[model samples]
Target chain A: MTSASKSLTAETLIVQEVAPRDGLQIEPVFVPTEAKIALVDALSAAGFTRIEVSSFVSPKAVPALRDAAEVFAGIARRPGTVYVALVPNLKGAERALAAGADEINLVMSASETHNRANMGMSCEASLEAFGHMVAAARGTRATINATIATAFGCPFEGPQAVEKVEALVARYGDLGVDGVTLADTTGMANPRQVADLVRRTLARVPAERLTLHVHNTRGAGIANVLAAHGAGARRFDAALGGLGGCPFAPGATGNVCTEDLVSLCHEMGLETGLDLAALIGLARGLPALVGHEVPGQVAKAGRPCDLHPAPARKAA
Target chain B: MTSASKSLTAETLIVQEVAPRDGLQIEPVFVPTEAKIALVDALSAAGFTRIEVSSFVSPKAVPALRDAAEVFAGIARRPGTVYVALVPNLKGAERALAAGADEINLVMSASETHNRANMGMSCEASLEAFGHMVAAARGTRATINATIATAFGCPFEGPQAVEKVEALVARYGDLGVDGVTLADTTGMANPRQVADLVRRTLARVPAERLTLHVHNTRGAGIANVLAAHGAGARRFDAALGGLGGCPFAPGATGNVCTEDLVSLCHEMGLETGLDLAALIGLARGLPALVGHEVPGQVAKAGRPCDLHPAPARKAA
Candidate 1:
């Protein structure tokens, strides 16, 4: 349950679109480079302040995004929108920097089991590697966002400890990363856990410097977002049409849907600075690109304000 | 955006299962009488305190629930679980009474346009008819639950005024109904509106006597339930597997999903007195009965605590 007085808070919520990278990375089929670029352009035109373009990793590791360089090069970069790319190590960081990424999102799982399972290394090794990547970007104009994967819960390790996440974030803060992201890698977060963890994390990091990457695998994605936002988390990562999943986590579904999250924020009178209609259009068009219908609801159900015409007057 | 002090409220939340009636009523295929009875029996065995069996509307009006009598007659009633049925008029009330329903859910719409379109009469006419139905059940052991459909918003008409809902509930109170349900018929409700209206309704009615019937048409059903529950509403109506939709409202989905809502409540440490695993089994079996995939998430995503084994160790 939520607090009545707490629900009345009005503030500008920042939604960072991540469909181009996190959303498409897990797809079985590789999306064409042109389509990925078009999606990024469309998202930028729709007024998103931030968009994760693609991940610069070994093509063998994530073949779906093998065209990361082509995508970043082809997209029509908007003036105010920051384009980000996920970087796994120093080599990936070099590629991301060369591809003109505005920011590099370096990831390290909180749980050792998950870090080993996903990244093929121990948590300490991954952090040490991130240190190299952070140092490599020192002279570049691009900033760095250190993302702690499985920050909420790990499929291999179960619920994660808040102190573990705090320690990892403190390390990232020490590395001088521009921002920190707490990702619910398996969609295993509940509202209470999210609120508690976010509140604790905020005490260590600034609200503007923290972001939430939530998955809807268990249907708590939107609720967790509300809880985290209520706990002073300002930036949220959402995938258009609820695309993407964790290949390592069995039965894990898509990330928190972009249009759905925007709809929730807009309906609650929170400003998102994103055009919902444009986002819905892009979400509706995702099925053809991904070869299936997406999990986003607003495209199918329409907005709350979308009214239907009254039934035709019955014959007298 | 959320006050830290406000998250400490702990209260027992009640979830009223409504799949047998509201869920089946909108289904295009008519579920067999035996299957309906089995579903209700399984739900009763799952520890739900309340289960709506079926509606007593004209068979021609809702052919899917045409076997309401057989369903009500056949279920192995659980002593602690209250079996309810929807009744539209005096005749329907008589049938429900004969079929051994413990409670009769009377239906009327708050919006005049919806009331006329749904019930084929004016608001006053429906209330007057309910008066007759109430009078006819004077000596019966069955209680009455007055359900104001589209209490939050109407697909044909925009938002229904809070005064309209208050006046309707006042009339129900004057008629001596046992409980009142605010039905978000088309899923047009937002959290703020739900909280505002629920708070206003609770001021006029007792919390124990109020129920929230939410639809997930716009993905706000669960959020609305959280909002209303925070505003002092204790009872809620949910359909298993998110089965059901409003035939009158285009693109309207099912009621707040029973499994999903129970998952949220259980995760939040709220008591629902329902076995989630058993309920999920019943929800998963619904696709066979209704000839389509149900919209629930738990059946597909599994619970957050349902963990997977770690991947096999990779050779060095």
Candidate 2:
């Protein structure tokens, strides 16, 4: 009935869970290793096809996820659940590979200034390093995926040029990565920008190989996801309890919430193969785990299908 | 570049400010009458074409806005700006017209159970009352608008039949409302549902007379707005600082934020005719007035075009 509904063809949408890695990385207190494993296992059991378990960065860099190795080793590997890990360089890639990561996700900023501030290197240098890292894991069991951080806009640089993002996708495709994720590092993406980038990126990479990662920092995260989905891009990265933020990006908050996205997709008649009730249960545990309230909403406001009893007394 | 983007052609989107009424109606403490007048004045100077100043309901019914008449009398009304007031019955409508309201907004719930619970009357009773209220305001200089609350879904009734909403809208048209607003009272709305309802409603109403009012309860407020905008809904109702929630709806939160929506529209290349910087400044003052934090994002995150300085030291 609408252009957006008409543009969407695929019935099933892929939701890649990134709570453990992206969500907890910015926390002041480190989550217990067992809790990390438990969170990933719960997400896996809740029907997530892919889960970013942790990152293989230096403990000094992100002390919260320092127990990445223990977390990976402790999780009960579900056969269908592909475990993913973020890698900064060849050393991190090797660590992740040794920890049995099914997919190694590499990230670089689309904005040169953000790249310099975040990775302590130039965009050219980061791509060169990624090329070597991809070659190193070419014959391994791990599939590689490159993420263009700040693909929508940068905290240090305004809106990124669509041509630069498309070129980055092309470069990653040429580098022989299994997939690519366009990351809105600070929730700076709008739905229109997302649709434009997703449409152009799809020309360079197949739908199955592209992921849209967004944040609800400016309240357009889910809208951006809807735009990408309408443009035929399916896979999405969301954090459980809407936890996650870039420490380097001022005013950055939660990523597009997992349960909320699943709820919206399910309501729109899109299959996410997820248990919304179970996801809500896990989200309800986030505040206690992080010692603060999380930004997720569906956990607080039940699904639309969840009916309430009539009020006992008349409301004024 | 994309279907959704192509669907948006009107360069300027109308933002109807509902903060003075919807936002403060649910507040625990009453804002001073002078403060309310100042807010209305500030919002008028900020270029809002329409502002819901207050409601003419009984003081016992909505004590927060008890000084509605005083507030209306104290403000300096601007030219080209419509000052609206919510009227529950013929008496309320008369009161609003006597107080010199530019537009009288009448509201009824689409869901029968919600209507009964919220208004302490059936949908038929509310409609009958609105008929009289509309008739009362017809000969006056004030324009009349009818709002269908819980148009998306009702917490007590669940998903409302689109046919039922259409019937209500058609009935409102027959009663001769100058315009109509479809409100997602508790934010139980998704992008697809919004697109469908908006497209169907637009078939019965012209683009200029239809307004989409959504809340950020489940984090789909902005997305729903985007969907409606794509479906040819040019007018929208937003609360400053994302303030406002239905007291009858158990888990209700803030309405779609004014500053966040404007920031998004500007970023998406849509004109709102409102000042983003001025709106953000007003939003920043919400905490002091309400004695708590608000749910707004852009007030904290800044606009996407807002850039940050490079970190002095490299971020790890």
Candidate 3:
């Protein structure tokens, strides 16, 4: 934890690669366990300090990620990279710990309607369950990260209240969770909203203990990230090929593309400490796995500095 | 001009819809003249104060927009909405003026390499030609706009010098053009670059006389627009359904989507004065016109306020 904290300087932003977990989880075709392990291992070499490997949810609920245990077990962990797993309950947390997850990420929607639809639980019940899981994980080496889904907005319930989100984050703080992720599950976030909410959240939570998970459903993902960064957030969750969609958020698109975000940060002179080319290669390779072109732009357009030769003129 | 200028208050931004012109110029298939007129008429009804109708270039050079004459002649002109046409040379300007275009938009690449590749002439030659066009349009009731293409970067000649762009804008000002458009022709612009360039350009050009034309080749289009807006640029050129691309820049994607940009402005409480739902409907109609799905996101994902019903729960 000391080394991880030290690695993130004032100029450095932490990009937690979540393609294996968040991206693949929403994919219809179940990616082979070996392929998932390969992706995680490749991402580990791409200078990412953290990578979310898989989710330990009910097999019936998300069959695409049913091989989470196999993927976690098969991947060769890098020395400094923190590999995380999404845990829906105590059972999932227990399975994740057993499979050697460095951290367990818990998710619950901020809106009661969304919470009921997504997890079949009330917000209070979800918080109580996470509290129990926090206690249960205290004995293990794994840390806990409570992600409040639809923290920005909900499909079933338009805009979410900032107070509701703040209370949830406060509860996660009280439960001694390692961090909290404010996810724009359906991409309903705007720059002004992001700046305001992130500024308020930083008042209660440390910047290092916060991560912004923005979706591009409305094509405002990168702008929202910039606003959150301006408001003192240092960590963001992105997928390799901009893959990931909330099953609950109608018309929701993928998470912000890792390559696109990296390109933006690099262009702005913000240090991301990640190999952009390696991430682009990974993103380009994803269409083969997903059976279609992904949403990432940098992979196709090349970096801003990638120049082309002058075309040969024909005789006029 | 006074009422139009008055409508654009400090809190208001002008959106110049360019789907009929710049958006379809690089498209492989030629949209019928009637469809182009229909789109222009619908956009005029949607509260767009300005619309780029078509480019009067050589039919041999750009067959996709060869019906420019018919498009400009067929559309019923709206009183408040200014109908503009792209004029590459004195011939194009004459054709535009004859067709009753309100404004003639002259284009020339800032980079010598791109100028030669795109317009088959040196930058000096293109500017000289535009100078003649500007002089020719002086007595015609048609205003002139000098659009400096590849103002941010060139595919053949990397990043453009701000000094060179400023010099061009200063030249356009000397030539007595009505406006100047700094085009990021290849989508190679970042927000910081946009802010710096727009701020410097605004020092030499009036806010009303300047337009920021950005492409989304690298996914920074909307962010760049926001930066330019922050730096005192009030007018922007956007394409319906993100339909435009630079033929000279390899792998360059579409111009910023008009509906998506409108959504962003509306969400931020900045007044666009455009009917968003009507614009979205026109955007949704673009696929049939172009024979492929367009790139705008607002049509696919809908607006943020568009809510969905909660899923009916089954007995657990």
Q: Using DockQ as the measure, name the better of candidate 2 and candidate 3.
A: 3
Model 1: colliding residue pairs: none
Question: After superposition, which runs of candidate 3 have C-alpha atoms over 4 Å from their true positions?
Answer: A1-4, A7-10, A246-252, A314-316, B1-3, B246-252, B314-316
lDDT of 2 by residue, B186-206 (tens): 888988889999999999988
The 10-residue segment of model 2 chain B with minimum total lDDT is B1-10
| Candidate 2 lDDT tens digits, A1-316 | 1011222348768889999999999999888998998999999899988899999998998999999989999999887778999999889999999999988999999999989888988999999999989987888888898999999988887888998988888888778898899999888988888888888888888788888998988888898898899998988999998898655444445899999899989988899889999999999999999988887888888888888887763653
In terms of DockQ, the best-performing candidate is: 3
Write one digit per residue (lDDT tens) for candidate 3, span B106-126: 999899988887788888888
For residues A1-316, write the lDDT of model 3, one tens digit per residue: 4135775566678999998988998888988888988999999999888999999999998899999889988998888889999998889988999999999999999999988888888888888899888987898988888999999899889999999899988888898999999999888888889999999899988888889999887778888888788788989999987898755444445898899989978988889989999988898899999887787888888888888888875232
Candidate 3: CAPRI quality band: medium
User: Which regions in candidate 1 have their CA more than 4 angstroms from the true location?
Assistant: A1-10, A246-253, A313-316, B1-10, B248-252, B314-316
Query: Please, what are the lDDT tens digits per residue for candidate 1 over residues B223-303?
Result: 788878878888889999888786654444588889988887898888777899998888879888888877788887777
Tell me the tens digit of each residue's lDDT in model 1 across A111-158: 998888778888888888989999988899998899999998888788
Please report the candidate that would top TM-score against the real structure: 3
Colliding pairs, model 3: none
Instruction: Name the 10 consecutive residues with the lowest summed lDDT in model 2 chain A.
Output: A1-10
